[model samples]
Target: QQQVRQSPQSLTVWEGETAILNCSYENSAFDYFPWYQQFPGEGPALLISILSVSDKKEDGRFTIFFNKREKKLSLHIADSQPGDSATYFCAARAYQGGRALIFGTGTTVSVSP
Candidate 1:
């Protein structure tokens, strides 16, 4: 039960629209939830995160809505822009040791004109 899955290998969202990326995990022991946004040729950065104790988290144009019981979560990008085009990953911490994150397959979002 240690898996995180994401949908849409890639997406083309229009500017000003909201882009939604879906993620789900099967592991119930994971406590920490974090979403990383990566631009072309750049490392992923922690865009926003939520603990299992909470159901939602938000930061700037990014927001994470989680459902612990359903073992699911989603990333919402408000006012999508071309600059926002990138690959988004949903990660979780299962083990306390280093490299605890189990990342989703990832969703490449392309906000276009």
Candidate 2:
């Protein structure tokens, strides 16, 4: 079974609109949550992350809203631009999460002007 899951397999947005991506985890031991963005032909890059202690995290236009009690989280893109089009993934980690990362099915986003 997948420990992490993501909603809306894909997304299409207009420029300037905010894009919201949702994620959930099954393991309560997971204390580290990170979101990654990947462009075509490139590896995923760490966009932002949050610890269980934080309810929210933000970096410029990217934000992560976390709910530890519910074991859920969401990533928000503030300014949807064509350049922002890519695949987004949600991952969780614990002290024993191991060298292999637990990844959710990615959400592919397309932004059009």
Candidate 3:
């Protein structure tokens, strides 16, 4: 139960539209949740996150809605724009071995004019 799954390898949203990205996990042991956003050729950076204790999180135009019972979560980007186009990764941590994080397959978002 160490798998994080994501859907839609790529998505395109018109400017001002909301971009919805979906993710799910199989590991119930995972307690840390973080969403990472990356531009082309750049390392992923934390965009926003929600602990399993919370059902939702928000930061500016970015928001994450989580369903602990379903083991699912989603990221919503409001006011989509060309500048917002990037690759997003869903990740989780469990303090195992103090190694690193477990990342999802990643979703590439394209905001069109």
Candidate 4:
């Protein structure tokens, strides 16, 4: 069964705007979250992430807003570009180690100029 869930299977946004992707998890044991960005025919790359201890993490135009209490999180892409169009997966892993990362269904983002 899928433990992690992501909203809006598909999204469209303007190039200069921000795109927000929402995620939530069912397992409280999960403490590490890493968002991945994948383009067609390419492997998914690590995007931005936030630990359960932090509420937010930012990298360049990408940001992850986390809510540990609610077991939810969101990825915000600022100043989106056409090149940013890709599928994003929200993945989680437990701190206990040795467990494989659980991924959400993924959100496909489209940036329109």
Best by TM-score: 4
Better structure of 1 and 3 per TM-score? 3
Task: Return the candidate ranking by lDDT, descending.
Answer: 4, 2, 3, 1
Error of 1 at 52 (Å): 0.7
Candidate 3 vs candidate 4: which has greater lDDT?
A: 4
Pairs that collide in candidate 1 are none
TM-score of each: 0.92, 0.95, 0.93, 0.98
- The residue-by-residue lDDT of candidate 4 on 49-107, one tens digit each, is 88999999999999999998899999999999999999999999999969998899999
Best by lDDT: 4
Better of 3 and 4 by TM-score: 4
Estimate the TM-score for candidate 1.
0.92
Q: How many residue pairs clash in all the candidates, one count each?
A: 0, 0, 0, 0
Query: Which RMSD values do the candidates have, in order?
Result: 1.6, 1.2, 1.6, 0.7
Error of 3 at 46 (Å): 0.8
Cα deviation in Å at residue 64, candidate 4?
0.4
| Per-residue error (Å), model 2, residue 58 | 0.7
Model 1 per-residue lDDT tens digits across residues 1-113: 53999987899988999999999999888888899989878899988999998888888989899999999999999999888888999998875667568899999999889
Query: Which clashing pairs does model 4 show?
Result: none
Candidate 4 structure, TM-score to reference: 0.98
Off by over 4 Å in 1: 95-99
lDDT of 2 by residue, 49-97 (tens): 9999999999999999999889999999998889999999999888574
